[model samples]
Target: MTLDGFAARPLGFVGPLDLSWRDRSAAVEVVGQRITAEVTAIDLDQGLARLSMAATEDSELWAYLKPLRVGATLSGRVVSIERFGVFVALDDGPDHPVHPGVGFITIPELSWRHVERASDVVQVGQRVSCEFLQFDTWQGEARLSLRAAQPDEVPPQPKRL
Candidate 1:
């Protein structure tokens, strides 16, 4: 919910005050600050507003991630290999805040067979293409599946109840 033309042009948020530009902006040090998100919820009691970085909120980001829907192929270079998952700096898209990459392939999603270490399957700087699983709102990551990317000759069919 963005107002087209509002008098208050928000700039940067200092310790307490949210400084704006058009009406009254700021020229503080905000060079590295470049992450956008929608105000999901406002917890007045906690004095904090929950923000989520959804593609729907960011047009350009959405455009890049739109076609890469569930089961769609997404290729990128492995930027970081962690105990929990493998992070890939996608070929295209905005940078992530916490992760070195936006694409996160968890241990379970890393392979069809059991694995010991995530590094066993992939290594840092290695190139990999995984299938999109889902968009995690809280963590702001694209949960991906490398196992699904390279399926068995005869994939198992889900049994109908």
Candidate 2:
């Protein structure tokens, strides 16, 4: 959430405003040229300051730390199911496919009890809470999970006929 400690620096000029250091890590101006240099120490005499990079290589990490946003809830109905995952329509948000990978909940991750099909546990038209596990910004795709959405319940054993 706080990038304050990361690669902070200041933008200043020794001559004309155009002859100052521009931030290349965040944005680049066509006229101004910024020389990239590692920060050595803070210049207290010259009144230099430190500003965060604003961008990070690990956005997902920050997203994970961010508190659950109010009204960010997406209501989706189960569309299809497989041994590996489930697919759902997340209203107007995005079509989320809950898989079995790092962010998905598979048959194995459902419950300690054995599960055959995801449909058996979740049916079509049944609204379930879907949370983003990981978002692929470039692909416009997100890994979702319903395991947390469903209320905890103890499955009843099959009765003898």
Task: Identify the candidate with maximal lDDT.
Answer: 1
Candidate 1 off by > 4 Å:
1-63, 153-161
- Model 2: per-residue Cα lDDT at residue 148: 49
Which stretches of model 2 miss by more than 4 angstroms? 1-72, 94-105, 109-113, 136-140, 154-161
Against the true structure, what is each candidate's TM-score? 0.58, 0.38
| Candidate 2 local lDDT, 33-116, one digit each (tens) | 533222223458875533222213233432442333432444566665666766555555422222211223456545444678
Expressed as tens digits, the lDDT of each residue in 8-111 for candidate 1 is 44422232122221122332435456545445456676555544444334455445554567888888998998888899888876777556887899998888
lDDT scores of the candidates, listed in order: 0.67, 0.44
Error of 1 at 4 (Å): 13
